[model samples]
Target: MGEFKVLEIKQSIFEDNDKDAEAVRAELKEKGVFLLNLMSSPGSGKTTTLCRTIELLKNQLRIGIMEADIDSDVDAKTIAEQGVKSIQLHTGGMCHLDADMTRQGLKGLGIEDVDLAILENVGNLVCPAEFDTGSVKNAMILSVPEGHDKPLKYPLMFSICDVVLINKIDVMPYFDFDLEKCKEYIAMRNPNAKVIPICARTGEGMEEWAAWLKEEVNEWQTN
Candidate 1:
């Protein structure tokens, strides 16, 4: 107790991260690359959904993907097999990717010719929501098996997302997930959130998702 020093470390860290995020956003805007930060819990079908999405839009857009994980390059391998530009990002022991990490991943992926670059963030709802990745839009997927009560437990994730994809809708009959109730919960927390129910495996409900993405990318490019 010789000398007591109080440091507001958390606030300072967040402020610095925000500045980096803003710079990343400006750089992406100038290059006309629409980066999407996709967040979700593990087993949410994010990879399958992305494969379907690439199939739908690859002909029209030059797409690249950054598959982020705490370990392993499995998802990146899966995406590369689809013949799109893909890069694997290892976060070491970190749970989330901050703006600087995202910028590094983008550089590795080489976004110069990429029209739409998607960062498939590490599988989690909490840490990913806490950091800004500087994407043009934020999106998350909540599969039917995960239930309709997730928003009640993880409000911040839902609150920050521009769109929420309700994946594994094909298994809705087997699960007790209430689609309308889930939508209600998400809407209560995020009134402007767009919830799209999709079955990525069978390609159901993907058209609507693709259309929304097309519109979003077009808007981002023009304005």
Candidate 2:
């Protein structure tokens, strides 16, 4: 066998992406825009939760949405109906978006007048966690059907998030999902993570989630 060079491509990619992410953050901060990177497994009700959140805070804050997916424009279209600026980002078969990609999406969404820009990241528990999207805050949705052990399974995802939303709580009785146990697991991974239980469909516990977001945006823009 011939001598081969090991380039450490993965590490290099992350290093470059991290640098780009900081630039993205600085740009948002300068514009007084709060960018949120929201992630979850597919069908976790992210869109529905976003819709409910928009309903709650749209009046007070200028909101924008960037819906990223491997394909399809469904989520972007859905968000546009809420009367907020929205753009769809196709990942071109990639599972997650890096900081440069996020920056491009932000530009397309136009953040000059936006106070809160939410990036609905491509649904997945793995790659999305590995890439920094340059958001002010990172949040993920864990629905009841996904099981409480997710935090234990995807520790990186849980540990990186500033907040975790337990969606589909209204069906907890049928799913055997333990809310307390989920929170405990999350704490094990990230002691500072805030966990919110909610049913986006019924608007249950959404007020608290929206309140948290509003406070975060206010703080990001104010300070």
Candidate 3:
């Protein structure tokens, strides 16, 4: 066989995607929109947490949602029930949304009147963390059932997240989920990650989440 040139396709793809992500951010800034990328494993109560967040901030901010899935509109319909503007993004068989895909979703969602745009990304820990979706902030939900060692296992995911919401805290007593240990592990990976314990089912600790979002949106809009 003849000698062949090697191509680092993965690195090249990420470099191109990073450029696209920066473009997406510039466009969002021009429109005064804050795009939040929310990620988690399946059954982590992302939808439930989002619904509660909408209830808290919908009146104060013009929010829009982009529900991304491989091939389902279930989440989009669920968000529509809350009376907010929502659109479903089908990623075909892709495991995650890249910056170009996110830009397309934003265009389809119509950010003209939207102050806050949320992308409920595909439910998973691995692929999503590897791709930057051009979000102003990245947040993830970790449920009690998922255990405290998630940060140790998925260090990249935790490290990239600006905030981590520890969900299902109300059931902490039933499970062996160590909240402090989880926080410690997360801190080891990311010292600045804001960790909040919340129960989406009970509306506990949601105010702090909403307030954090509000402050982020205000900062995004003003500066």
Candidate 4:
């Protein structure tokens, strides 16, 4: 007779994170908060987009932001100046934010009455796409300089995004970025994603972006 040993490996790292994210979603829904998880690589105009978005929407909707960075309060300050409530989440060297950190940032905002909330995830395309931070939508920004080949290079980020902002289009003439190729890649990876181009610095294409934000926020209020 042979005795067989069966080792029990009952551990799930993402389990608790998923649970926390679900709770965060429920909390936002109950409070009528429309949360957007914004992702992008460094120097992609993500912070500028946040500031411009808040400036455009704050008058109509109560908007707040949670700015996640490797280490910096500059983005948060920029958003706050637009009269939008904002909190900076320094990742302390981490590349991205998990549900727990996002929940903590949300708690700090204390803007339950706000109609819209945007979490500016740490400027890294690879890591931010992996975790769900319980946001209503996953948004991403891709600047012209990052190259049109990015969606293929970082497929996860493109695949998970609900909306994609092709930012810094004003610099299109100076760069080798191809508009059609980027759109094609996005379509191939995530056909459902809504894509918008913008130059957040000059306020170009901002109205359309603001319009989408309004509609998203209004729908949040209703649902």
Question: For residues 51-88, what per-residue lDDT tens digits would candidate 2 score against the true structure?
Answer: 99999999999999999999999999999999999999
For model 3 the local lDDT of residue 198 reads 96
Model 3 bad stretches (over 4 Å): 1-11
TM-score of 3: 0.95
- The digit string of per-residue lDDT tens for model 1 on 67-181 reads 9999999999999998999999999989999999999999999999999999999999999999999998999999999999999999999999999999999999999999999
Question: Candidate 1 clashing pairs?
Answer: none
Give the per-residue lDDT of model 4 (tens digit) for 1-223: 8999999979787788889999999988889898899999989998888888877887888888899988979888887888778889899999999999998999998866788988999889898888889888898999999999999999999999988999999999999999998999999999999899899999998889889878987887796
Task: Report lDDT (CA) for all predictions.
Answer: 0.96, 0.96, 0.97, 0.89
Clashes of 4: 0
> What are the TM-scores, per candidate, against the unseen true structure?
0.95, 0.95, 0.95, 0.94
1 versus 3: better lDDT goes to: 3
Worst 10-residue lDDT window for candidate 2 reads 5-14
Query: Whole-model lDDT, candidate 2?
Result: 0.96
Regions of model 4 farther than 4 Å from truth: 1-7, 10-12
Candidate 3 residue lDDT tens string, 78-168 = 9999989999999999999999999999999999999999999999999999999999999999999999999999999999999999999
The count of residue-pair clashes in candidate 1 stands at 0
Those runs of model 1 whose alpha carbons end farther than 4 Å from true positions after fitting are 1-12
Q: Which structure among the candidates has the greatest lDDT?
A: 3
